[model samples]
Target: MNKIKLTITGCLGRMGQQLIKSAKNSKNFKLVSLTENRIVNKKIFGLKPQLNSISAFKNANVIIDFTIPKCTLEVLKIASKLKKKVVIGTTGFSKKEENLIKKYSKNIPILKAGNMSLGINLLMYLTEIASKSLGDNFLSKVFEIHHKHKKDHPSGTALMLGKGIATGKNKDFYNLMGKKYLNKKTFPYSKKINFNSIRKGEIVG
Candidate 1:
């Protein structure tokens, strides 16, 4: 079997580090690039990705991005232009940014998920079923954990879980940004995504 050529954007992140370790242990993958603001030039498993720019990965078979919301669009544009398969693991995209991603997907194979780990995916599925079974009587909340430096208030995984709850109750996303400003009753929903974010000191990069 031939190896799948892979490049990782946001390569210094937790997810990126996980992928790097997995790829090193697997016989089926060959990592060709590692793009991040930090640690881009570091060698992995004795193989250095000869790259000075993201465009160096033009021929890469797959590009997995875990970059921040600020960088997601620019990276997606590059991937679309190269006609490469993309796996988007970034989160916190605005409505306009999401529509742009949809537009870009028409040109190539794209798979977008806030959480890429198989376990998290199953959790979302189960949450949907439980939400449906439990019905509108219960309100839903969102919570998550990440490295101490994570900037987003609610983790992407938390929001994905919230969406699963909405599916169970059959409701659209309730933008919980401002309830008191708009008067809470204007949008009717018993369930809301309550997010709790934590930032603390941690040594693992």
Candidate 2:
């Protein structure tokens, strides 16, 4: 069987490095290209990282993205033109940006998820069930902790959980979204789903 040609964006990011390591070990994929927002002088896995562009992703059959929202959109534009498949692991997209991604998907195949882990997906499923079981009497809130280097408050997983809550309640995720607290000792839960994010240490979850 032929190996799938793969390209990874945000080559300097935490998820980017992890993808490179995993892709190198896996037999099902051949690492073809690596891209970053800025120029990376040194070669990684014998391939120099390039800026996001058509040339950077032209040779790949699939592109895996774990970058910021702006960078992810940039990659989508290039991949759409190239007609390349994409797996989006990036998060923190605004409503407008999410709509934009939906528009791009009309042109090419796109699989997007905030958290790609099987465990998280299961948790999201359970969350929805629990929210529905609990009904509207119980208010919902989300809390998350990540490595100090991680950016974006509430984390994507938290948002996913919030979405599950919204889904259970049969309401829009954006409408039920509440306050986002960063590094707060304590927060309150309201009618809307509040979120508290703690960033510290080197926790990988």
Candidate 3:
């Protein structure tokens, strides 16, 4: 059987490194390219990381990206022209950026998710169910903790959960969105969904 050619963007990030390790172990994929936002002089897994460009991704069937919203958009532009599929695991995009992604999807295949884990997806589903079942009698808020290096507050998974709450209430997530508190010991639940994010040690959760 022929292996699928793969390109990994943001190759220096935690998820990027993890993808590399997994791709090397998997029999279904062949890692064809690695790209970074900046110049990388050293070689990883026998391939030098290049900047996100048409040439970098031209040889791959699919590209997996886990980076900032700006970098993810850059990758999408290149992928759209190359006609390659993209799997986006990046988060913290504003409503406008989200719409931009949707626009790009009309040209090529794009699979995007806040949290890719099955367990997290299940939790999001349950959240929506609970929010709908509970009704307006109760208020909802989201809390999350991640590694200190993670820049985005309220993590993507947290936002997903918030969106779930909005879906249950049958309202827009942005309109239902409340305050975003970082590293707060205590926070209040409001009519609109509030979020509290805590960044600490290198915990992957």
Best by TM-score: 3
TM-score order of candidates, top first? 3, 2, 1
User: Per-residue alpha-carbon lDDT of model 2 for 1-205, expressed as tens digits?
Assistant: 9999999999888899999999999999999999988878999989999999999999999999999999999999999999999999988999899999999999999999999889999999999999999999998789899999888887889999999999998889998999999999999989999999999999877
**Global Cα RMSD, each model:** 5.2, 0.9, 0.8
What are the lDDT scores of the predictions, listed in order?
A: 0.71, 0.93, 0.95
Worst 10 residues of 1 by lDDT: 177-186
What is the descending lDDT order? Answer: 3, 2, 1
Q: Considering lDDT, which of the candidate structures 1 and 3 is the better prediction for this target?
A: 3
Is candidate 1 or 3 superior in TM-score? 3
Model 3 segments beyond 4 Å from truth?
none
Q: Residue 132, candidate 2: how far off, in angstroms?
A: 1.5
Residues 12-128, candidate 3, lDDT per residue (tens digit)? 999999999999999999999999999999999999999999999999999999999999999999899999999999999999999999999999999999999999999999999
Tens digits of lDDT, candidate 1, 39-126: 4456666545443255656757998777787667777777777888888888877667878899989998899988777898899999
Best by lDDT: 3
What TM-scores do the predictions have?
0.78, 0.97, 0.98
Compute the lDDT for candidate 2: 0.93
Write out the backbone clash pairs for model 3: none
